[model samples]
Target chain A: MSDALHDPGTGTPGPPATPVLSATGLTVRFGGRPALADVSLDFPRGRIVALIGPSGSGKTTLLRALCRMNELIPAAVTTGSVRFEGAELYAPEVDPAEVRRRIGVVLRESALFPGSIFHNVAFGPRASGFAGDLHALAEEVLAAVGLWAEVGGDLDLPASALSAGQRRRLCIARTLAVRPRVLLLDEPASALDPVAAARIESLIHSLAGDVAVVVATSDLRLAARVSDVTAHLDRGELVECGPTGTVFTNPRSKRTEAYLTGRIP
Target chain B: MTPLATRDLLGTACRLGAALTLTAAIALLGVLLVQALGVVDVGFLAGAPSRFASRAGVGPAIAGTLWLAVLTAALSFPVGIGAAVYFEEYAPRNRLAGLAGSALANMAGVPPVVFGVAGLALFVRGMGLGPTILAAGLTLAMLALPTVLVTSRTALREVPRGVRDAASALGATRWQVIRRQVLPAAGPGIVTGLTLALTRTVGAAAPLLVLGAPAFVTHAPRTPGDILTALPTQAFTWSTRTEADFAALAAGTAVTLLVLLLTVNLGALVLRRRLR
Candidate 1:
């Protein structure tokens, strides 16, 4: 097996505290065709883990499985345990909505609602029944994502008025408003220019000190640059995972080497 | 034929078909206007049906039609929109839901007279409402329900999946996501569909005829329990008469009906814009 290079000890981060989120023996199938097979990963608090792979290599499926987001698809069947703070997320008693609120996701698309800038940012907290002033909360999250200054504090401005880069940042800010313990971003910066992408990456770097972040991306360079740990997958199987430096410079498996060197799609 | 030549032919055919439809509609309108030129006036609008053609007025018929339209809308819209929301936003993708969806689609294509027959059995005779405005209104609402449900589902489906996913990802419950995002994004489309469905119901005559709407009534309906008389029935009664003057009065009633439908459509247009 290509997993001969998979050293379980090196693959897991030695965080001072228990992981904020982790997936064990996770297998996801859509219409009985496996998308991810027996994959395992950990996301400890205040750390960034980047999941990288070629197109349709189950990078997205893995990210969705981590937070129980795959349940939304009618044909998708996920088997395994995803734990948040040592509690099983897939248990019958667990509310998927509650799990989602605690673990926010920013999709590949901006996916802004048809509303003002403030509404988009305040949506999470308001939907969760925030008792505090929503305006103050909107301003706080917008500033956190570096959008307040650019928007000139016009909270009432329609979300569509913003540029593409600004809209992406607004999506991130929306997720942050919920104060999630873990953030899953699916190619959040893939649609942006290099400069805008750098801005997003820096924002993500700034956020790593508080929120555990998992980014799924095709951009190997991005995965190398932002992630503390990197996990690579190929054909629904995890080829290798370890510290970013080791995975990049000295991949243990030929598949990992082939993918990193652009030898395989 | 070559692919490019065939494409050009198809485009020309489509344009010709569209022009033909538009021309036919305008020509019909022109004919109605010419026939009703001298027959229609405030006096004609305010008078009741009579043995003397000049004395026949459509005031009571207009009122009945208005009442029927309002009742049909009140009965149909809430139920139809609610069913659509349940099917689109809440229902599981199971056999039952698939069966229900197909049932609604098939019902949308059912002849209006068929609904009238069912309505006669259910609301008219079975419910003991008699051939009153309430019975007619209930029948029309039934006729309109399937269209509204089908159109409403289409409108809800028009909303992008990304919007729902974005809201769901925020940890918003299904109800919250529907109320705050899905409904708002789909509001204009839903309103547009409702407007078209309502206009269709308002113009329907076969169902009313089958419901046994009175050919002539002495006064405008004062309540839902009052005897029913509508523009379509009045026009039908007049048009069926051998008198030339009654035929002219029928044309005038048709003109009035067209104007009323136009007004309703215009009002819905404004509502649609406001929703957007």
Candidate 2:
């Protein structure tokens, strides 16, 4: 329930103007159709930001654009600037591999690699050029996610053999292996039961302050409970931005209020 | 009509069709066998093929065919599978790669006789290797290359992308992904392609003629540079003989060739079963 779990690094805070991540007019067009239109936001370190909106609200598109993952899809055209740690992420010399390593992503589908749990957790660190004991690192990260006991003994088993909830936790553990500065998660607990969802929430709570955590979910209860800041998107637009309690308890926009009261998905 | 009666009628018709098809295949095999037995003596197979080979034994021809086939498979098998993996797994899904891949696949179906002329131009006269088993082997490699390449590509393509993505998501480079996940998963298909290409090369004669497989080798060719004598050329020579014994030799060569084909096919079957 506290941010003590992660080491957020040298308490040297940036200028009130120095953002951990800042985007400027990000636009992604797919076959002349606007998937994301001139999206821009600034995320600071030690923050838990919840991206909440109806399905197809371009939250995922925005997330993909941030990582430049949309370029992998043909007919995708992007025009934007994403600066992470004040370095241009889309610069010609900037390697996407490095970007992915520094900024871990967790998809709703749980991108669990088809291998043993040890290998799955070791993936990012290995890809990012981790030279130390990978097995120890995997064990440490799995323990951080409170899954070490369940998967520790069976670190050699296929990932597909895991239960759905365990696979989701393992996915979180896999991302944590890299020790990323910025974490992007989409619907991390939409598919889970209340108990599993609470565990994920606790993990997110523990991750805050050490890393910038961004979660996109339709669960208003989740958005209200865990996040510090809430950004509402509707039809590819950032409709509202404010403190989570303020946004949910006393929404400024009619749409946000309607959404908060279950008038919309 | 009663359900059982309709089922019985359908079953009866299916059985009749299957029986007829099986009988036709068996009869064809039987005819080939009878011709082989009637013309060739058991002595033809057992005796020193090199001594009576020009007239009776087919050791030289058998050796030639095996040499050419083995050399061709050895050269083409790795290259074909590598190309297939590159095209299917590593190549970007763009227009240029698509066009080039299709062009290569189409090249496989071109006539073997044409390949013979190509081999003559590329590996024979052009390279001035001049009728050596090496030249013939390379020609045979070129002839089988397209078939192996296409089959291997198809096999690699059939592998689920999920396995690849899963492996890659876990620190695997593109080549490592292909080696560990894609190739193993698609291995059976590769073996099937290899067997097919090897069989096709064994059955080919026109290319060996262009590449100049020797007709009267007195000794077994252990080296690629040695002039080789393959079964088809020996069979051709024997079939031209005025004596009945030479005709028997040709039939015996055919039987030996058939057995070799069956052996390769069985090996491929075992590999495919192991994959499952």
Superposed on all Cα atoms, the candidates' RMSDs to the truth, in angstroms, are 5.4, 5.2
Give per-residue CA lDDT, model 2, range B44-76, as digits (tens): 553335444444566556677788888988899
- Poorly placed runs, candidate 2 (over 4 Å): A1-18, A108-115, A190-199, A262-265, B1-17, B24-63, B89-96, B159-188, B231-276
Model 1, global lDDT: 0.88
Q: Tens digits of per-residue lDDT for model 1 on B46-162?
A: 888898998888999999999999999999999999999999988999999989888887898999899889988988899998888999999999888998999889999999999
Binned by DockQ into CAPRI classes (incorrect, acceptable, medium, high), candidate 2 is incorrect
DockQ of 2: 0.23
TM-score, predicted candidate 2 vs. hidden true structure: 0.81
Model 2, residue pairs in steric clash: B39-B248
TM-score: which candidate is best? 1
Every candidate's lDDT: 0.88, 0.77
